[model samples]
Target: MCNNISFLGPKGTFTHEAAYILEGNLIPYCTIPAVMESVSNGECQFGVVPIENSIEGPVGLTLDSLAHKFDLKIFKEMVIPINQNLIVNPKTVMNDITDVYSHSQAIAQCQEFIRDNEIQPHYAVSTASAAKSILGDKTKAAIGNSKAAEIYGLEILKPNIQDLDNNETRFVVLSKNDHEPTGRDKTSIIFSIYEDKPGMLYKILGVFEKESINLTKIESRPSKKGLGKYLFFVDFYGHRKDKTVQNILNELDGLTYFLKVLGSYPEF
Candidate 1:
């Protein structure tokens, strides 16, 4: 069995918690691309990185990296509920904090709280990184999860500080091989249309509709080629190997300028 699983971390990050649900030795990397590169080069058997958040939308770097740099397939997926907390040194109180640090997504999640308290918000590489940086500083606090506070020996000055309580993040496990058809699976794909014509996107989407395929999610990101040019990312319910799904792909092949099957994995 493969042993090492790389995740975005220095420990105490939300991705670290998501890594716990998988088997093998957990290794931490500083960035999402680093984690993917570890898996691509076989340094690790698998890697976990956040793909999207309910409140903050898609993680652009992760999506862009998968679309452009990595050939790895998504082997599995996990969705975890999020709860952000205000973590600080035990000796520090709310009045002592002038600046707060955390991942950009985490900071955005707690915008209301930060504005209300008039604390300067700074972005860190990861939530745990932020918590670790303020270990002895009374003027700085971090917005992270409870586990981060515990791991760093910090205190939670405030709990559940996110703007919304239903916050969740979706993480994907990257691996060299696609998972076997699990009957109930979701396939992710990326494609760019041929022209800027008005019906280009509509025609491509119609391929799925013609087959009655149920699409779970759809979003667009810049292709980085030029302005108004984009790549479309889609998730749908069905394994890539399914006959119906295969036929849909065959049809899409002719309609798109570029097409790539990211992977098929058991849906969360």
Candidate 2:
């Protein structure tokens, strides 16, 4: 029914952790697009996928899929602390580990440790999947959270191996509808310009400035239509239904080549 929620999985992935923010029968998918596709095709009522990581910037696949492939709304956001650990078979030790496996992002986050230990890096679809792969194999270790170690019956060879101590990831819940406006809310939108010009973008920002809306984030992604053409994604502190936000969007709609209100959800 509508209670089924999909997440990037084999369970124990960060997205899996974020999916717990909502109550549902959590279903696991192999990829972010798969999770989104499940929701788009009505196989699941909601899906949770990571939007960005503190250490490595945004998850481009999730943003690109949301911009192009899926017509989904972000229902909510959940932020989770990430502590990358070196997980190994119970019998394996640091010296026995010759190769490491994990999602590219995880590998990137723990590059320092990998380099210091002289372990060859291999990529897996997800950190949980990496943990699954190294089962019964002593030479290979996986970099992931502690939950993955527990789920895969592995041992934590080293804890908090990520380069940074304050690692976190922001995940979004995708569904057909956005959350109802809470007084404290945030709106995300994507837009493109008619032509590349200096003042054009400046004028768009001016609208928010004039309305006194606090802009939280602004990022650009290639529109993929042509060179120099890009899509601008903006997150601001207000609900789409709020009068001031509506004013800013109305003005933006008229100014840009096209504008899409991504969604409005309670600020996390």
Candidate 3:
């Protein structure tokens, strides 16, 4: 197993939380691209990247990076609960808050809070960077997490300010080797059909249905080879080693023109 892990951001971001869950040490990068590149180039033993958020849907860049550049496999999965806290300089008060700084996704996740408080949102590179920026300006406040507030020595003006109480983000740990099944596992794969004919997707899904396998998610992205072509990426709730999952894949192998099993990993 790999000890060193890298994630997106400097520190105090949700990605950092994922890295903490994995191994307690995180090498933070400025962007998801950087994180994936580091892992692809073997700069780190493993890399964690956000795949989806309960509020904002799938992270497009992460998905695209997985589809395009990385031959890396999913080693583990983690779900980090998001709790957006309003943080500001020690001297700043709630009334004096003018511009609110945060990463774009963080701002979107706290849309209701921002709207209710009439706080103008400004984008920063990351949540930790936002906190740093707020500390530099007395009038600026940040919508980040408690970790960020603590890291930057900013006071929490308000806590748990996210719109959804159960807000969480799912992250995937990437490496060159597949993880051994831990009973509770998930398999991810990408496939392209011969054609976009009617009932083609249903026909593909029927294989899993017949095997009684459960599907977790299904997303489609452009094949990027050219216009019109598309690829279907899917996550299912079973390890590849399981009999049911194996049967489903055997069925799918007969149907798909191109298919790749990304990995089978321990579920978060």
Candidate 4:
């Protein structure tokens, strides 16, 4: 078991909440990159980072880091249901809120609420940070989870304020080593096409199709090495140990300029 784990936090961020479910000594860093760096530098045995939100799509930095920076393995995944609430200092009332605050994603999730309430949206680095700032202000409110309100001793003015009732975010657990396959597992990989030519991507995808592998997710990110170049990240429902999966990866190696299996773990 990992003795120490780190996550993106100042306290009360969603990532911090995810870490609570895993057993470890919790350390909080201020940014996503910092969290990954802590795990890469051995400051923590594992790191928890948000990968994507149901409404917002893939987290760009986490995807980019997996492809370009740290050679870490995604050992586990946690799916959390997101519930954004309107919180405020005890003295603040709905009528008193002129400026609303929360993380950028939170703001996006609560667009209808913000627009309906007629408050200016102020973006904070984290929902907890926004909740913390409501300490002495009466004309401001924040959108965050119940944990943030409890930690900051604020009042929840409204509950379930997110536009959609079923909003969720997927987070991944990062570690230095890979795990053995469970009967049910998922593999993640990144590959760059040799050249941006017609059917180049289609031909690469054909290998997966021919093998009958089920792809769970696929996303492309800038390579950062050059313009118009991209690295494709994919999640498929099979372990690297499986013969069919192994054969497909072996063939994929010859089809791209570079191919890397990020990691595989039991499906969540």
Candidate 5:
């Protein structure tokens, strides 16, 4: 029940669209760090940040920030379906465009279209920023959501330009307030093994198997301490407070360099 929420944006970014449910004061931040920091420092009651994508994988900054920067907890999650469109000025045509602008990730999502059109890709801070920058320019275009087109008074030259038909991003709601256990919930955690012994990862995962916990996702990110040192981020179907999950976590503490429970949130 947050009264205000912050998201990565200047508006029209997918994160902005995903945050509509809060129905609160919407604050747009420039970067993921700024969004998380806003909630950590009490500038806002909640912050919405993208954590993973169906095609491109985990958002690195969000993972690193959750693992290292803030002690915030995830309150909820939602999957945002991405429909990247080719947006242009009303006077522009496909062949008339000289350059296309968008966030790097958006450009990648629309690679097939960009390659086919032969337009140079310019990176922008956000999809909405790209749309805003292309105003009054017949030679420029942007790749972003339809909202960006509406916000910037542009037109959708092509719709659903993403490489895949069902492209989507998973976003998490971050807050200083801890969430109570919902009957259907998932727990996220990050752990690092002190030793690089063989089967260490398998052994860690074994705890989940022993306790009958169903793991939905597992990914390794750099530990940032040194090369080849990594921390494993695991998501599974159950709250941290559940008896089985607590038992597994208690056992994991002894086998890990450190075990940090990122949060327990209701599944999207």
Candidate 6:
């Protein structure tokens, strides 16, 4: 029932692109932190945020926000192919570029290219924003994508410059209500175990194994409330309606002090 959406942006950001792919519309916002806040406060009916990237790993801020501040549910998922491009102002060419600007993740994905080209990497707020900044400085280039280069009217010096060609980012659609299954689906959950206990994770994962369910991803984040406690977030490849997935949840329900079924949504 939720219609209005929001995402990390000043527009032209990958999060914005991911939102477009998920909702087929633009949800205006300025940052992932802002997008999560809007969903938590009901400022928007739904929000989209990048959870992980194939080349760069987890987005720590998004995971932490989901773990602590929000009671949000992920209603859908989207996998957007990342194609990092080296962009420069129309007046500037490849050899004239001395420094590059982009979000930290973008810089990380294009590390090899930057190192090999001897271009200094400067972290900007977002990829789209980096492209904007490049428009102001002729010597400064940016590492973003083709969409961003197009949006900023910058010339693409290089395309698909990411170290990995299979680079993809996973975005989650968040809302207050759970999603109905679309036959093929995926479920996301978050839980934690005692920091001092060994094999606790193995036993918890064994539940999924015993039920013959496949885990799509597993990641750990600092609890933030304290130094030692940690939280684990997992994505599994089935809907909650499936008997095997339900049984796996039933087993987990009795074993963990804290557990939350974040969502059951059509897997993309």
Model 5, 5-116: lDDT tens per residue? 9999989999989998777899999999999999988889999999999888899999998888889888888998999999999967788999999999999898888888
Candidate models: Cα lDDT each: 0.94, 0.91, 0.86, 0.90, 0.90, 0.85
- Give the better candidate number (3 or 4) by lDDT: 4
Cα-lDDT of candidate 6 = 0.85
Candidate 2 lDDT, tens digit per residue, 147-181?
89999899998999999987999899999999998
Best by lDDT: 1
lDDT of 3 by residue, 64-156 (tens): 888776788998888888989899999787789878999998898889888888889999989899999877676789988888988989999
| TM-score of every candidate | 0.97, 0.97, 0.92, 0.96, 0.97, 0.92
**Collision pairs in model 5:** none
Clashes of each: 0, 0, 0, 0, 0, 0
Ranking by lDDT: 1, 2, 5, 4, 3, 6
Q: Write the per-residue lDDT of candidate 1 for residues 1-268, one digit (tens) a residue.
A: 6699999988999999999999899999998999999999999999999999998999999999999999999999999999999999997888999999998989999999999999999999889999999989999999999889999899999899999988999999999987999899999999999765679889888989999999999999999999889999999999999999999999999999999999999989
Please give the TM-score that candidate 2 achieves against the real structure.
0.97
* Model 2, global lDDT: 0.91
lDDT of 6 by residue, 1-268 (tens): 4467888887888877777765434567876778878887877888898999887788898888887778889888888899888898886777888999999988999999999999999999899989998777878999887778888788887888999888999899888876887888889999988666788889999999888888988988887769767888999988888888888888888777678889899888
Candidate 4 stretches with Cα past 4 Å from truth are 225-227
Give the TM-score (vs. native) of candidate 5.
Answer: 0.97
- The better candidate by TM-score, 2 or 6, is 2
Off by over 4 Å in 3: 225-229
Per-residue lDDT of model 4, residues 160-238, tens digit only: 9999877999999998876699999999999998664667789888999999988999988888879878889889999
> How does model 4 fare in lDDT?
0.90
